[model samples]
Target chain A: MNLLLLSPDDLRADGSAVVEDRRLQHMLQVQRVEPGQQLRAGLLGGLMGQATVQQLDSHQAHLTLLLDQPPPAKLPLTLVLALPRPKMLKRTLQTIAAMGVQRLVLVNSFRVEKSFWQTPWLQEDSIREQLLLGLEQACDTVLPEVILEKRFKPFVEDRLPALAAANLKLVAHPGEHPECPRALGEQPLTLAIGPEGGWIPYEVELLRKADFAPVQLGPRILRVETAVPALIARLY
Target chain B: MNLLLLSPDDLRADGSAVVEDRRLQHMLQVQRVEPGQQLRAGLLGGLMGQATVQQLDSHQAHLTLLLDQPPPAKLPLTLVLALPRPKMLKRTLQTIAAMGVQRLVLVNSFRVEKSFWQTPWLQEDSIREQLLLGLEQACDTVLPEVILEKRFKPFVEDRLPALAAANLKLVAHPGEHPECPRALGEQPLTLAIGPEGGWIPYEVELLRKADFAPVQLGPRILRVETAVPALIARLY
Candidate 1:
């Protein structure tokens, strides 16, 4: 873990914390941190700073925290993605979170298998766990909000237009389309990416009506995981 | 599989081919191809086009080849990457290939675990298999060339300089450095990315001596998998 993320419950009134869970184990084993050493840490939904390890043992690691610095700024983007397969969903969650995406809408497309919705990885706790890993990887504290939309039409027709009203709305599709814009300088954006087979023409039409301009990266197609970072980097 | 990749042995003198492997299974189950149906296909290291399914069954699928179109252009770049752990290595290989990176050098660094060098994923056949999957995903016919460097100092001091000579040489380091360049259209580039813990000062110094300019993505640290696409997108 790049940064140890602690929940409010883990902190004491005196600005100290005792980590006895996976974080402690990871610090002891993977990081090989010893008592009296300082490590970077952050509070979930709070600030980030350094923590001095006071006492270390097999049971727990007592730390005195100095949380003074604010977390890194999130990207000014709301990502609308067609829910990927279960295995990909887990990694994409971590990727999007690590890349500083603040909001995500996992919507359905015709090509998305109904079975994908039933995956255990979509459970609240499972999703949070993946997001936490991403936060730790990126050394950030703020968690991105995730919204699920099982039906495509209602979400796009009723909600997407308003959600994307003031933002640069884009749908990343491989076709005869303009290249995705670069370094748009912090404008709020909403980008839609499709399932493995890509958005059907009907879905594309619906999205187009919702104001998402179709854009292409190049002729070569990329997987959802790869596409997310590529689009984010190019846009901002 | 988006494109069925065929080896020379799979072709017949009569301009036909028989698929009796995973491609056949994918065609039978995933694609559900029938006689007289056409499917996108590509020859390994060759052109891409459509194939007409002349005969189909569980045992095999016979096709008439009509190859014409050229594969997508590869990035005019050579990537120098610290060998990641096995799982990440597998995914990264697929990603680089799909993103049209044609030349890659997997090198050793201080933080790269010794066991990473021994992974079966690094074997020629295993690497080829992953690259093929990536080519299939991207619908391209060309396979990327992968080079392995087991020793750190020798490779960097001896070979990397010449390999990166006359190219825009960049080393991605997470620290105070210039932001990575953008849209340097079609310039040949050689980029070096480090292991999870990042390149040590010594390594960075050696790379600097070799004439690589250090570049940073941002404050947020990204996993190697995420960084590859992000860097490629920004650079291209």
Candidate 2:
């Protein structure tokens, strides 16, 4: 873990906290923390700074926090993705979070298998845990917000337009379309990426009607896990 | 698999072949093959075309091939990476092959764990299997070349210079460096990305002395799997 994330519950009025969970285990084993050592640390949903390790053991580590620096900037974009298979969802969550995505909307797509929705990885706590891992990996303090849309049509027709208003809307679909644009600098954007089979014709038409331009990478199709980072890096 | 890859042994002089392995299983169970079915197929390191299924069964698939089309183009770049852990190595191999990288050099570094050199995934057969899977995933037929450098100084000082000659030599490192360049369409390039813990100071200096300009991908430290695709996408 690059940054030790401290939840509000773990902090006191005097800015001291006791860590005894997985974070503690990571600090002890992976980081090999020592007493009097200062570690890069941040408060979840808050600022980041250094933490002085006061005590260490198998049980817990006593720490003193001084969260003075603001967290790194997030991308001015909202990602609308097809719910991936459970295993991919875990890593993708961490990938997007580490890339500094501010928001994600996991919407249903025709190609998304119905069984994917039943995965426990979609649970709020489970999602939070993965996002936390991403934050720690990136050494960022902010947790990206996530919204779920199990029903595709209603979410697209009723809610998406308003949510994506004023943003450059895009859908990463394969076939005869312009290449996905590059280095869009500061433009606010909302990009929808499809499933392994890609968006069905009807779904693409619906998104097009909603003003999302279709973009292509190339003749070769990339797995979603690889595609997300590629698209993100190219865009910004 | 997106494209069914056929080895030379799987083909005959009459251009008819029998597939009885995992590919057959994928055709039967996943693709749900039927008699007289036409499927996308490619010869290993050769042309891609369509295969007509002549017989369907629980054991083998009898097919008629008319291979004509050439495979997709590869990137005009050579990737030099620090050998990752075995698991990441396997996945990274597939990813690079899928992304159309034609050559890769895996070198040792100070930060790389010693035991990573002993991974079974480094074996030629295992590496080829992963690369083939990647080619199948991207509907490309050609496999990328892999070069292993177990000793650091000899390879970087003695071999990398000639291997990377006439290419735009660059290294992906953290800390004060220019942001990586984008879209150098047909210009041959060579890029070196470090390991998980990053290149130590001495390693970076040696690379710099060898004429690889350092490039940064902002502040976030993405995992190597995420970084490879991101760097490839941004660079090309």
Give lDDT tens digits, candidate 2, residues B42-104: 999899999999997999899999889999999988999999989899889999999999799
The digit string of per-residue lDDT tens for model 1 on A113-193 reads: 999999999999999999999999999999999999999999999998888889989999999999999998779999999
Taking the candidates in order, what DockQ does each have?
Answer: 0.89, 0.88
Pairs in clash, predicted candidate 2: none
* Model 1 lDDT per residue over B122-176, tens place: 9999999999999999899998899999998999999998888899999999888
**lDDT tens per residue, model 2, A149-189:** 99989998999999999999999999999999999998999
Worst 10 residues of 1 chain B by lDDT: B1-10
- Residue ranges of candidate 2 with Cα displaced over 4 Å: none
In angstroms and one decimal each, the interface RMSD of every candidate reads 0.8, 0.6
The lDDT of model 2 is: 0.93
